[model samples]
Target chain A: MVRSGPYDLNVHCIPESGDTIEEVVAVARRLGYSGIAITNPDSMKQLPFSGNVEGFDILSGVEIRADNASKLHGIVGKYRNKVDIIAVSGGSESINRAAVENPGVDLLVNLNIAQDSGFNHVLAKEASENRVAISFDLGDLIHLKGGSRVQAVTNCRKNLLLIRKYNVPYVLTSNARSCFDMRAPRELAALAALFGMSGEEAMAGLTTIPHSIIARSRPPAGYISEGVQLVYNEADTGNIDEGDR
Target chain B: MKLLPPTLRARTRYLAFEVISQDPVRREDLIRELFSSAGSLLGDVGASECAIRLLAFEGSTGVIRCAHDRTDRTRAVLASISTVKGTRVIIHVLGISGTVRGATIKYLAGVDVFNPKDSHI
Candidate 1:
């Protein structure tokens, strides 16, 4: 049987949160997750960066939470090549726009304010064109209660519609800070259903999109850009001056 | 009291789950939390449609009976629950089966279902 193992694109460990990476990974494995990315902001120094923990994949991601557009752009530039994933913490309108417009940013995480959805058709178009994935952080649904939870669901539903209409890539994340906050992939899919996402779409978000994002960010050495790479032919390997032999 | 014929009876699914908590949680508190979470998320009428019931709970693992078609909805209810009796908890669904026995055998392995002491009733 072929199983598309699920990957959580957003998780916190160590310096960013109280729980250690090993503890979070152990709980995630018990829940049947294939891997998890530790997206701790400004704490990349503490991560192994490129290796998996005991065969389970561990991606070193950075979550950039800045106050304004300039600062957000500056941080994105610095971390663009340093991390496997770049997620912008969405809150204000300008920050949302800046995130989607920059191809360097992989995910615009949690796109909502108190009442505003913090997203629109323009941002959706930009996200689609830039290939920036929109993140539906289900952690809000887990952490928020009563009226706030209802509000978060409503906003997510609205964002889902826009994402579908624009054909933008969207990712599902528990946004877990600890083992208690983490959930199995199936449970995450169920919570996504509460916000109008179909089972298939949820699965793609959990597996396919995240995998593609990781692959896209980290290319083989001598990589230039998309559809462009440095290739060396055997004949071209020898210097022209020495070809006289 | 007459029992409904097998052909006319409602189809049900058994979901086996495990409770990972900060503190040891009793069966009663877990049941209470399940109902409230389902009720609040799915509403009263929706909860009734799912026909969710706690069939058996032993230690941290348990089996819940729900409508066959509502398994996903029941999963959402379980996922929505973040706490039980003020203690932080996560109820992760182990697996689902058409029959309670199948669920127990497949997901609740190592637990003696027939043992009275293991029954949290």
Candidate 2:
């Protein structure tokens, strides 16, 4: 397994203010995130300047939250070719199933945000088959406190246990809305322990799995199926006119 | 009273942490936040047991003394602190060591987060 540092691949929309994205980048870079994907549901286009920053990579992602299967499929088809990671907001049972069943959906995140234990065995199996990584968001822990936090953690642990049992890929994130909400990797690992995730397991979600997802989802080079690239033979391309303009 | 035996005395764990904030941070403010967050998150009993003591603060880095077994709880308490005096700040635990000097040198040697040249404000 590659030992690259963690990447927070699911950050909510950050309002386009004066260099606000810069602030978020600085925080994530300082916190040691090697890569991050800003998942905004409203944005029509990716960040034009999302490139390498002080050795950190900024990836563009889209989040599609739909009320029904048809709408979810429509959004997925629309954004699958546009974003790096196509995330589906999975809170209700219907959405969870739709997200897992759809091959265009790359990430199934926040499955338990709105309800108690929104994910299940069937969803887990489908997600595994579709190669959709589940998200274990630590930002929710910060938003809640006391018994509610405890309950949330408990629900997360339950979901994690099922995800692990089925051997489905999972990812960890702060789900930060702003730069201030970002956290260190160790801090996130410790919080994951509260939800029955071992340190190594949590680190894998933060680093290895996300890394694979990014690698697989990256816009293909000379694009084609895995291991097959469209080769442009020099002889066939020689007839094309070359102009500096 | 006689000194407590080694077996009975609580073991110490030094946590080397970095504070990421927009403004210069005061050591006293960190101490107060630690106690407040610890008290609020873990309650009085848990807070007293952890007994977080600020050993050193240089620039935006610091070493804190916490109970050996309670290191997890102390780290958790520190992570719970989101804002210090209404300014958003992140307390990142670099690592834990048995000696304050070890933690200081290992994680925070010549820490320059609050350096005058690097100051954001």
Give the best candidate by TM-score.
Answer: 1
Docking class of 1: acceptable
- Which ten residues in a row are the worst by lDDT in model 1 chain A? A42-51
Candidate 2 segments exceeding 4 Å error: A1-3, A16-19, A43-46, A219-223, A226-245, B25-28, B43-49, B114-121
Writing each residue's lDDT as its tens digit, candidate 2 over A111-222 gives 6566485788988899889888888888777667777777778779888888888898888888777676778777888777766688899889888899888877774456
Reference interface contacts recovered per candidate: 0.51, 0.33
Strongest candidate by DockQ: 1
Model 1 alpha-carbon miss at residue B119, Å: 27
Candidate 1 stretches greater than 4 Å from native: A1-4, A43-48, A221-224, A234-245, B110-121
lDDT of 1 by residue, B1-121 (tens): 9999999999999999888875678999998999988888889999999999999998888999999999999999999888899987788898999999999999899732221112221
Clash count for each candidate, listed in order shown: 0, 0
Q: In model 2, state the lDDT of residue A229.
A: 68
lDDT of 1 by residue, A1-245 (tens): 11258989889987777777777777787778877788887534648565565657777788988888988888999888777888988988899999999999999887654688789999999999999999998988877878888999999999999999999999999998877788899999999998889999999999999888887876656678778755654576855455554
